[model samples]
Target: MVAVVTKRYQILQYVSWMEPVGRRSLADQMHVSERIMRTDIDFLRQQGLLDSSKSGVVLTARGRDVFTSMDQFMNEMLGVQDSEKQLAERLGIDHVLIVPGDADQSARVLDDMGTALAQTMQVMLPLGEQIIAVMGGTTLARAASRMNFQLSAGRELTFVPARGGVGETVAIQANSVAAAMAQSTGGTYRVLYIPENVSEETYQPLLNEPSVKEVLALIDKSSVVIHSVGEALAMAERRRMSDDILQLLRDHHAVAEAFGTFFDAAGNVVYKIPKIGLRIKDLDQIPYVFAIAGGQSKAQAIQAYMQHAPKQTWLITDAGAAQSILMG
Candidate 1:
């Protein structure tokens, strides 16, 4: 009986929300053919759970009771609540949101994590003018795309790239991500065009440029910083680092990379590229810092970086990563 109810639970829940909805519509929403749905609908109908008519289908009183009762069970089935609590305590983060699935195995999981990030920003963003510093990465780019327009409603927002990112592809660069976020949320943005990986000689001169200085000032004033962490080797590859630098990361047993600096599992800075941008120490100043990443593959990197992450930081990851961390 439990197995039967669980199998058809989604159908009942959907019908409850969209009462008087046609079976054709329900089938479409559930991504199933009418033939496939008929069997469950018939079984549910015979069990006095839901009624189908020429007009549509609606849950019976008993069906509504069952659906309501199973709401928590649905969430529990995904194990999100337990994972969220455990991950936050272990990581010492202020908040943690764990979505279901391994993002590396499922693109949809990444999309879902992006949605979770947008929702977190909505809650964390405080009143008054907000300067949001964003970092470059594929994860952040997905987040920028999924940002809701309502995020801009009745708010003042200015998005700025957290650092220079000339080393990355344009699509996932901080500049592009900041601009995309502003556009989606109906806000404004500033761009930083300096190279992310620059030597001390070139870095000093770029700081003298008025435009660069202006953006740097905005970054300093940013109230919130949104960024993602990467595995050291993967990030070094993304930046197209020299073979010598790659070898250095390997030699140091670097496990995580953030803000142009690589770290081992114990959070010691193995090496840092002289990039003109947000430093890890700066996070202590920002009232809100959101670190978003998922996939079990990132569990080691996330754990490594969180060792040094600010206590105020909010981590958004998936169940796969969370479980992996707790298992350790």
Candidate 2:
């Protein structure tokens, strides 16, 4: 009986995440046979929790309510509720939200983190005019994609890139992430066109550009900031940093990279890339800062970065990362 309840809960959860989903597709995702899936679907239909059509199946009004309540129940059942509190207390951060599964083992976990982030924003976002600064990266790009149009329904929000491009893939650049988030949430976006790894000679000149200044101003006044943490060595290699800078990070034992700043396990700044946009110190003044990163491999990086994170920063991570940190 307990097993049956767990299966039904899993079905409801998946359906909620991917509504209008076909039976075969859902079965494939759940790794169950079509015969078994059919049985469960029929049971749910009889319960008036599901409405099926030729195209796909979705939750009925009662189903939606049940699923919403079930989410909290499942979190408690899985011990995530306790883990979230313990993690927050241990890390000394404002808050922590952990989704199930290890992102390192499954790509779907990343999408789930994105969903969690969207739901979190819905509750935390205040009304009235607001500016949101967002940093770019693979995790953030995926997470921001899950934000819906309704996120901006009652608020006047503008999304601005936290920094300039850092020679990463275009899809994961700060400007691109900001634009995608703005489109997803029905908000406006401002771009910073300067390069992230700028030299002293060119830094001031680019910062003086009217376009750059405009976006910088928005970032400075941002009420909320959404960004991701990255493994230090990987980020350095991705940015194609010079041999000397790479050596410096290794010598300093850098473990994490965020918003162009690299930190060691102790949270001491190892290096900071010269560029225009929001600085680490600037987060103190921002009302809300969302740092989203996961995967077991990122545990050290997440911890290293959080050590320097502002008091108001909220971390959204996965069980993989959270458990690793807790274990250590």
Candidate 3:
């Protein structure tokens, strides 16, 4: 009976993450033979827990409900709820929401954490004239995609890029992240088309441009700000920074990077990129700040960055990161 339950859970879990994947591929992923895995697939299809088409297997509405309903149960079972409390207490953050699973172990956990953030934002977003500032990163991109936006209907929302993004992928750029979230919610968005790294001489004049001026004004008025934290070295690698800049970050013992600023374990600014958008200090003025991140690998980064987080910040992370943070 336990074996049956586990098999069923694995079937739903794999299908949830790798939908449209073939039966053979699923067998390979689960490390089971197709002949044996066939039984599990058949059970789900027969129970109407999955829709298996030539296109591939997908969860039905009922299946998704069954899957989602397990969120709390899994969190409790994994002691994630307790971990969240511990994390909030340790980090001095007002709230910490932890989704089940570690993103580092399972790609689906990232999706789960993203869903949690989107749901929270849907509830917390104000009713009128809301300006949302968003940071760019893969985690935030996933959050944007997972947004159901059902509750945001009839609400006015304007999304703005929190910082310029030059070397990053277009999909993870602050402009693209803002656009994606706005598109999902049927809201408006403004872009700040400037490189993330620039000299003070170049940044001062660009901020004065009419197009840049418009977006900057919106960012300044943002009521809610959403962003992701990154390990300083990882972010530097992503940006393809110069050796000198990388050395400087290391020399300062930078642990986390956010809003174009790097901070050490003590939360002091170690380095700053003169991006023409929102700054870390600017978050103090924003009423609602949402910091979305996950993965055990990012635990230190999250811890380091949150030291500078505003009092109103809401942290949404997965159990993997939370557990790792506590362990350290």
Number of the top TM-score candidate: 2
**Candidate 1 per-residue lDDT over residues 1-328, each given as its tens digit:** 2233345877888898888988888899888898878877886676566888787999988667656655654555445656666788899876787777898999888777777677556533544588999999999999888886656654788999998865888999999999999999989999998875667897899889999999999999999999999999999998899999999999999999988889998888999888887999999989889899999999999999998899888888888888899998
Shift of residue 113 alpha carbon in model 2, Å: 0.8
For each candidate, give its TM-score against the true structure: 0.76, 0.77, 0.75
Better of 1 and 3 by lDDT: 1
lDDT of 2 at 258: 91
Model 3 agreement with the true structure over 1-328: per-residue lDDT tens digits: 2234346666778889999878999899989999988877776665556888898888988677656755454444345556666888888877788887888888888787777776555434545678999998888888888765553544678899987765788899889999998888888898888875668887789877999898888888999999999999989989988899999998999999998889998888998887777888898888888898888988989989988888678888887888888989
Cα deviation at 177, candidate 1, in Å, is 0.3
lDDT of 1: 0.82
RMSD of 2: 10.8
lDDT tens per residue, model 2, 171-225: 9999899899999989999888887676879888877788888888888889999
- What C-alpha RMSD separates each model from the true structure? 11.9, 10.8, 12.6
lDDT on C-alpha atoms for all candidate structures: 0.82, 0.84, 0.80
How do all the candidates rank in terms of TM-score, highest first?
2, 1, 3
